[model samples]
Target: MTGCGRREPIVTIDGPAGAGKSSAARELARRLGFRLLDTGAMYRGLAWAVQQAGIPPEDGAPLRDLLERTTVELAGDRVLVNGRDVTAEIRTPAIGELTSVLTALDPVRDKLTPLQRALAAAGGVVLEGRDTGSVVCPDADVKFYLDADIETRARRRRGELAARGVDVGLDRVREEVLRRDRQDMARSLAPLVRPPGAVLVDSTSLGPEAVLRRLLEEVERVRCCTPP
Candidate 1:
């Protein structure tokens, strides 16, 4: 899909949490020589700021002023919140819960989606998020929806947390994953769904390398028909 009368290539990879979209998008961007935009990190940064400002997650509403003042920057692998590096800080399970809330609020979506659009306006980018293909970059040239079984996703989330020293049990992780999945799909705004025209890739048993190879094949197929 193309926007703003621009024809530059935009690739959107949307998926459920723990589906490996983030890691795959980073590698895809590098392999394709495109910019990488982790839209989830943007929400995480905003959630971090809101949490820092003592905002209550139970409010169930967007704090306009707090959001307006917040700035999220993605510099390679580092994520900056208001000029402070909060990359490692934003990945916590606590923040993950908060981010789910933040992404659900209409005001928050209104504030952040435009920033995401501007960043990818020039295209030649890989965007990974729950709604990147459906909402943020609907006109993206190529879109992929990566998915895996719930247990697989739970195990992956558990492994990730363990590596980060969080050490959450698989049962606890499974519960959280199911909870977030319900929240994401049931939310009024930007609910997770497979975007139209997106290629579905089930990674239930596929490794990251296999996923990347399949994605590359799709990109090559798209490139073949694109006018030079």
Candidate 2:
């Protein structure tokens, strides 16, 4: 479905919130032996730092200041925010809400997009985000626009949390997931969307393993078609 049909296999996995982009992309990267770049977690870490620095979520000026002083990096499964290790903190629901506000700023996106591009350009990176396929890495060798039923996505998220000892009501998680998707699609800066010729994978019926397998298979096919 990718029009660019580039020989390089970048593998941009873009989707709305709770579409399993993070977990799936991480695992897919591991299975494919590629570097995992969790773009959303980067933003989440920024939002967390923005809040921690006594900056109001709506204060673009303070948020801008935070990103400048903060050193955000992705090293395997570890996330470093402001030269500190806070990988576990960014996953909280509160950080996600703040992340939505932080990334909406043109200043923030302006700052982060370049970093994302450089990382993806480095090669064999599995990048995940709302706009990865559409804007961040439009020429990605294999662009996958992952999708799933809203209900399924919602339930799966909650289940994942429960497995980690965090209990969230299914109904609440469901509604929150839908709301976030709407927000992602509506954001003016690099909103979530499928790029032209991007392959669409609806994972409502497929588990993570099956979905990852199918993606790797497609990647192999895409690779084979390329002239060495």
lDDT value, residue 76 of candidate 2 = 80
Query: What is the per-residue lDDT of model 2 for residues 97-129, given as tens digits with 9 covering 90 to 100?
Result: 788777778877887889998888766778988
Report the lDDT of model 1 for residue 225.
59
What lDDT would each prediction earn against the true structure? 0.89, 0.81
Residue 85 Cα positional deviation in candidate 1, in Å, after optimal superposition: 0.4
Top model by lDDT, which number? 1
For model 1, name the residue pairs that clash: 1-139, 1-140, 1-141
- Candidate 2 TM-score over all chains jointly: 0.92
- The C-alpha local distance difference test score for the whole of candidate 1 amounts to 0.89
> After superposition, which runs of candidate 1 have C-alpha atoms over 4 Å from their true positions?
1-8, 58-62
RMSD of 1: 1.8
